[model samples]
Target: MQETNDADTTPTHVETAADLDARIDAADRLLVEFYTDGCGACAAMEPILGVVARETGVPVVTVNPRDDPALIDEYRIESVPTLLLFEDGDPVRRLADGFVGAERVIDFLA
Candidate 1:
């Protein structure tokens, strides 16, 4: 008596810089999905990112580095699909330039 694969599987939209401060400070693992407006890979990875974010109950905010030059400089992000993992506001790992999956996300932290 269980249900999985709900039809309403929209990736929760995360759109802000300040929103991250609290979560980044509290979370052991933070996945920041950095992307631009017209990135094909970024578009493709949306749902998968959402699923993982929700499953983990972590703050997965999308940072448009191009829009915010400071972010680009802050994280040194040079790719469309970059996932920056932070531990207590300190960056522990970074996965970049592609549509990496959920298992891969877990693997990065491990």
Candidate 2:
């Protein structure tokens, strides 16, 4: 298995659907943002997610569902900037509103 530095606060980019599954399995609690390129709200959330990761010690990841068509269908992601909270490898919460602030993100994780 590849060694991962759990202390890293940078949001991970999930390139493929399988990689997304692997990441979720690896982390005890994970926040995944499904975003598309050229999306303003998605771009806006980048720094906010970074801060959330740093403040809460929760691993945050971003995935472009367009890169994996199956992911779009599997997650039923209808919009960019959809946030999914996964705990113990199962999805427990979803926040699909656009351009959510760091406070709301932190509260969702909490």
Candidate 3:
């Protein structure tokens, strides 16, 4: 089940807290990101993650922490570009603070 959005090749927008839980229930893999608009780290992370998402066939949702108030509080994300990889609703990998690089992301996925 592949979906498309302007954001990514297979993008799933998680705008609300309930959307998050619902998505987790239905998807096998979820790449959830907490990003801020003006953050350098978040900007760098997006394209790297875009490639990773396309290559791995993963569903990705990039959320703006500033806008998603509930999500910001729920995840306790202190920094921009916090990535959480979930397998069957369970967290498999978490890259907090910011995105490192494609290689690191690929290594984490592997």
Candidate 4:
């Protein structure tokens, strides 16, 4: 039987700009979520992202720009719950529609 509640399924949090760079550099392909506190849509994505990470075998990470404001400007974020797909340490695609399901998130990565 396979365990379904492993901590690895959960998305890691990026605390700083450097941390974000390091994570993006470490993974060949990564899904980075830009979210802010008190965001209902952002809160809804947590479980979906975990499922996305586990099902797609892609590492997912979340960063609240409030912790490091530079991330907001660096990523050119215009709203909360923006999903960015990074490949080879560069952002290749962006999905900022907000409150997407697991299938949509996985499709975005593809």
Candidate 5:
């Protein structure tokens, strides 16, 4: 995969929840964004997540809960644009307020 510092050039799309699990398990550290279609804040997080991935070298993946209804109840995702930080297949932190900037995201990863 090509790695880029610019958010516009990053490859951060995760197709399915199963793919998401494999990606997270494969990476030492990962940031997964749970989003919903037509969510303004969720849309806004795309580039920011890319920036986080580029700067921190932490692979970022995105999943729409609507794709899999079970994820909503499993993860307790009450809102759109919820961010989950994972370390070796285990979730470490969660950020689910709204549009979070790159700085806060970096700090959250730390």
Candidate 6:
């Protein structure tokens, strides 16, 4: 029997601390969103992030700090809807000013 993946074809792009390192390392430039459940601002950023991913051609991934508390300290995530841009496995920019428009995100990527 051929091996198969049951996961959806459309990428959810959610990452955990365990695999985050490898994921960022593989991408030339990757966007990571840190969020928590029950956050209104975080919820609002969903559509914006989707737009950023599509418009900028960057692989956007979400990581819930609650799943791995160390991520909070590691990334210095003081708030939800925080977006960090990693280039060559190193974080070079961060957007943690709460919900922002798609244009802002695209500019940040640039």
- Every candidate's CA RMSD: 4.4, 4.0, 3.5, 2.9, 3.4, 6.0
Residue-level lDDT tens digits of model 2 in 1-110: 22335554789898899999999999899999999999999999999999888888888989999999899999889988999999999999999989989999999988
Candidate 4 least-lDDT 10 residues: 1-10
Provide the overall lDDT of each model, using Cα atoms, as 2-decimal numbers: 0.69, 0.91, 0.75, 0.90, 0.82, 0.80
- Expressed as tens digits, the lDDT of each residue in 1-110 for candidate 4 is 22434544679998899999999999888899999999999999999999998887788999999899999999999998999999999999999998999999988988
Clashing pairs in 1: none
What's each prediction's TM-score? 0.75, 0.92, 0.78, 0.91, 0.87, 0.86
The candidate that achieves the highest lDDT relative to the unseen native structure: 2
Q: Candidate 3, residues 1-25: lDDT per residue as tens digits?
A: 3454444455555667777878777
Off by over 4 Å in 4: 1-8
Per-residue lDDT of 1-110 in model 1, one digit per residue for the tens?
A: 12323322233344455655565776665677888889999988888777765565555657677665777778888887988888778988889949878878757756
TM-score winner, 3 or 6: 6
Total residue pair clashes for candidate 3: 0
lDDT winner, 2 or 3: 2
Taking the tens digit of each residue's C-alpha lDDT, what string does model 5 give over 56-93? 77878888878877778877899988999889899989
Task: Output the better candidate (1/6) by lDDT.
Answer: 6
Candidate 3's C-alpha lDDT? 0.75
**Count of clashes, each model:** 0, 0, 0, 0, 0, 0
User: Measured by TM-score, how close is model 1 to the native structure?
Assistant: 0.75
For TM-score, candidate 1 versus 4, the one ahead is: 4
The global Cα lDDT (0 to 1) of model 5 is 0.82
Model 6 pairs in collision = none
Candidate 3 segments exceeding 4 Å error = 1-8
Model 6 clash count equals 0
